[model samples]
Target chain A: MTEYAGPLPTPTIDTAPFWEHCRKHELRMQKCLDCGHVRYPASVICPKCYSENSEWASMSGKGTIYSWVVFHQAYGAFFAGIVPYAVAIVELAEGPRMLTNIIACPLDEIDIGMPVEVAFEDITAEFALPKFRPLGKP
Target chain B: MGSLGDKYAIVGVGHTKLGKVPGVSSIGFNVLAIKAALEDAGLTREDVDGVLVKYPTSGFSSLFSGKLCQALGITNKLMAVIDLAGATIGTMVQYAAMAIDAGLATTVVCSYGDNPLTGPPGTYGRVNSDDAAFGFVGAPAGYAMAARRHMKEYGTTSEQLGAIAVAFRKHASMNRNAQMQKPITLEDHQRSRWVVEPFHLLDCCLVSDGGAAVVVTSAERAKTLNKKPVYVMGWGQAHPAWDIAQRESLTVTGAKRSGEMAFKMAGVSPKDIDLAEIYDCFTYTALVTLEDYGFCKKGEGGSFVQNGRIELGGELPCNTAGGLLSESGMPGMLLLVEAVRQLRGECGPRQVNNAEIAIASSQGGILTTHATLILRR
Candidate 1:
């Protein structure tokens, strides 16, 4: 495929590991050493206990749909032709919410508290976005 | 007996033509707004010791306020650009009063200017953020998600959200100066094209080119001003400072704590507020704020907004100048300006009768920050 025209994440020193995990199709979050609070998007310090000591813990990639919206308006060039995309805030079982698209499902069928699991969509050879799909659906 | 309550007052308010201005750059509107507000206050730039501006949202530069002051050929003892998004306007008044109390400056000008409507095509549509990578890059999407959550949690219907649009549009219809003069019905809101699901075109605010400013001075000094000074009885701010996905509840907002602090400072409660100029960036934003501000219980804003409860002449009239829904979408500064006007009884047809007390709310960055202000006639 040519270069992916949609938006892409620029990994920082902190978030590089998280993005790398995504490329490898592994879900991991930073859990504080002191407080055991898990966080997303890769942070240096624990927001709960201010602990700089933390480790990347593998996640189960399962969650519930806290909420969702189907955006009809294209906000950028990449979305100009293909809008009406549904975006959801999926609250992972690990207790952190992720902003992602719900795929492999009908838009009208999406609902709050619906069980879901991570499904990776590889945009480029080395990059993948972790979307979600209805639980137990092949 | 709050130390800051009733110590300062807004002496003047000014704004540019709403919706469409052909050639005015962002800073050009700031210059125009400050001059008009100064003239309205019967004062000149020389009398102003403080200048706090919320710069154009479309773009930003370090020392933007410095550039604005240089354009106006004025020097001030206190100057900075506040960047709380829509909440900056109400928070500016609080900061101005603090500066005055601390003897840093006596009289202050708080203003905002933007040209998103007329400046460059797709200016309002373009949203650059980390979330863009995942296919969400617009304001409406975030609010629509929150609105969707509110619906699922509280049985809030699309019609309930329509009440907000219908009410503010009705108020705007009565306001000749509003950008949208025609009143819309619930059916119109339902029929409007979807910007995002759970949000029609009516659910979103106008993209406007505008500049708005207000002059605040010591209450004692306001006694000498030309207009009937609207006293700044109370001011408070709250910023949860978390991303929407990280929030504890989508329906609850920073306005909850912000309003509590302001009402506590003003020695009043939500029921004491005769008129409220809430920042209605969208209909759901205002509805939830009405709940968070304690006007009604949590999860009850849907019913509370129905039955003519939030329109003009209703109990606890809100956004009588049409608000961002129908008025110019100048962020929230215009809401503060309108609140002052209503308190002064200057709103020709849409004024809240016997409006002795009013509360103006400003929420910034998709309900991430909030500021509440209580004023007295």
Candidate 2:
């Protein structure tokens, strides 16, 4: 078990849906209605066409290991024991990249373009962090 | 429009001591620098009607801003915090100009402060995200990766990278305020421990705790300032793809877009620049910025920095105060201060002779956001 003590992000009215989906172990992205562009950050207007109309769509929660680093230092007192953990940016198949941590895999084995799938770790009673694990060898 | 060539002077500039002052809080540093800037400009706190603040990790807190305002005895003014990551200093300048142009404020103080090097534990920790696996531990490694890619593509040698460190070290020897004044040699740089492969310990920048502030007023108001006003000729900013993989090309940065816009706005060519204070978080940073800023062609930065082209007294003198590589690193804010100092002819031994035009460029994040400013005497 890991401990987290930093301030938790409050899901405002605009961002509640995204957080709710994470709680349910689902990846959601905002899809623009005007130009059919998918956006990672939930926004009121489409970045491409500036349209206010948008919809939330579920994603496969699959992406490639775009880039990552193993932090030797702990982020906070709560994570002091978890030194030397790997964090990474995953490029979703839908074209949005997410900042996430890679787990259940050896650090040395992580590389660019490695296939990964999202896994939820319920940290607090209300929040579940989205981590990733390597896809099993076929 | 006024001729872009005309000067747009910097009325005031201020810098806090560069080191671990544990007793001083972040807001304390901001107020200290701002007060110095106000006095340097020979104005009262009430004279400042606009304010712009930028913090490293998070945006400014209203409580912090209010504390500084009360300490400085300032009340009732137009203000906004600019949170553009590394380009905060330049963006602050742009916002101040907008305020002046809009008649909302007369004198605007743009300031930045941080104490990461000596603050509470985990002060420099990475943001909570999943991207830590590739050992993207910190800014140094992120820049090291860029250096490695540059080497793989352009045959940029480690020796050439050392030249940047060595040159900046030489420049620091002449700057009393520079944090690291001891001279460094290529041998010393090569022998330094490896923070990340292809980037020796010397290749990384110092993580110092400090703050920097600059004051901008209308051209008319600047005429009465105590010090010579170094004009803000032009400024521009650009955001490349947020993710490193999404970049069109890693070696080339969006600095080109910002540089081109700044140059166009100032109506000056790269050759017109008498001096430059480009951000050098790593050796390759300056190399890539040189190409991106149009000083040299793309893919030519490796060779361009070789043979002391960027050294003091070179055709294009750079980082005359040793930059972040050798001097104190204040998150690229010091680069702007050095540019202002050089244009004002305040730099004694390391000053560029007859330096009438100067340009400064800074990038925040992993080359994701870039900002450039053109200055003139």
The most accurate candidate by DockQ is 1
Instruction: Please give the lDDT score for candidate 1.
Output: 0.89
lDDT of 1 by residue, B111-205 (tens): 99988877765435655555888888768888888999999889998999999999999999988778998989999999999998999999999
- Model 1 misplacement above 4 A: B120-128
* Poorly placed runs, candidate 2 (over 4 Å): A1-138, B1-7, B56-60, B121-123, B132-136, B196-198, B245-248
Pairs in clash, predicted candidate 1:
none
Interface RMSD of each: 1.3, 5.5
Error of 2 at B257 (Å): 1.0
DockQ of each: 0.77, 0.14
lDDT of 2: 0.77
TM-score of chain B of 1: 0.97
Error of 2 at A71 (Å): 6.7
lDDT of each: 0.89, 0.77
